[model samples]
Target: MTKNNALGTNVIAQIGILVHDIEKTSQKYADFFGVEKPEWSLTDTLERAKTEFEGNPTDARAKLAFFDMGSLQLELIEPDQNPSTWRKHLDEHGEGPHHIAFFIEGMKEKIAIMESKQMPLLQKGEYTGGRYAYMDTFKDLKIIMELLENDN
Candidate 1:
């Protein structure tokens, strides 16, 4: 694990994998887990997400598939050709486990804390009732940490 801050490792809600092919990888995961492949979707144009990279706006897009793993979720991401943290990982390291996520209640507070800890924001996206951001944790834990918030 990485160095502990207020939001330690206990809040992690899911593990996200960077995949070269969402369909292929999802099928492989399904076969390995003895279940059907979960449906995947690209960023909806109408509901299209707005993203930021290293604090600057970006055209990042990705295909995503989610699977329920009881208390946690398993996410597979296949990034599009837009500049994104996911694309950077895929380009630099290829497909593999990219990040772990924490579904936080007050995402803004957590993001501020993470920033205070010097974990610069790598990517962020906003949707209808939720938003998510990836912070640089690779230097500490060899994986990124995603802060997620859903308005429920």
Candidate 2:
């Protein structure tokens, strides 16, 4: 990889899609892929996740389903009626591909680099074993970029 590559790796770790009905959509995807339907679950509570949107704390949550596809994962998200990037995308753009994610280390540094390049942080949260940040890179890349840093 190039020395200037802010994300460190070029591999896409996951692709997230926003959907209105994760249950139906995930089932469809599972059938299409010939895999068992993955169980969908809600994100952690705001108290645990410490989720933020537009720089402020938020209670926004989503139902999430994941499918392992070789080197990458396919994520389906159905957001609650809250002010989050996921909800915003679903409202404005309708259900569709939302973001492509990269698993990386030094999340803070990577976020700083992306921000310096004009991609603002739209949302961020902590999961059970990791944290995630969504960068607004649509102006240049035509897609949101999700940075995932797992504490394994």
Candidate 3:
């Protein structure tokens, strides 16, 4: 098994929130945490990202923006339409923390380590020219933490 220093790892690179309304979600974050409002973009700019992330083409409908919190990035994602992932999550759990992401170098290795530790994966797949695996940790956490490995 590979030894990964807990402190050495960047545990939370980004956070995601699934919302039906970008404006509402952004406002909530800004007001609650005093986080500055983030910039929002449509599919035009996201086309270039179609092959860079782990999400599927259906994710293309998402509107994304970022705000920096120290070295971490807080990502606010609003799906373009109903019956989407954001919609599903919001319908089930309301607008809230959807996932936490860890940007790692070797996703396969990390996955192997997690599996060796007997951690069950909620989901795992390669997409958009990158690799991502999701695992559930602890009870009541609700949100899954995503392990992401980008080619870059």
Give the top-scoring candidate (lDDT).
2
RMSD (CA, Å), each prediction: 2.7, 0.6, 5.0
lDDT of each: 0.84, 0.96, 0.64
Q: Candidate 1, residues 1-152: lDDT per residue as tens digits?
A: 46865465476699999998899999999999998899998864323676788777777788999999888999999988878898999999998999999877777778888888888788888877898889997887788999888899
Name model 1 segments beyond 4 Å from true: 1-5, 44-47
- Give every collision pair in model 3: none
lDDT of 2 by residue, 30-115 (tens): 88989999999999999999999999999999999999999999999999998999999999999999999999999999999999
What local lDDT does model 3 show for residue 152?
72
Candidate 1 worst ten-residue window by lDDT: 42-51
Clash statistics: count for each candidate: 0, 0, 0
Q: How many clashes does the backbone of model 3 have?
A: 0
TM-score, prediction 2: 0.98
Q: Please identify model 3 stretches exceeding 4 Å from their true place.
A: 1-10, 28-36, 42-60, 80-85, 115-131, 138-142
TM-score of each: 0.89, 0.98, 0.62
TM-score-better candidate, 1 vs 2: 2
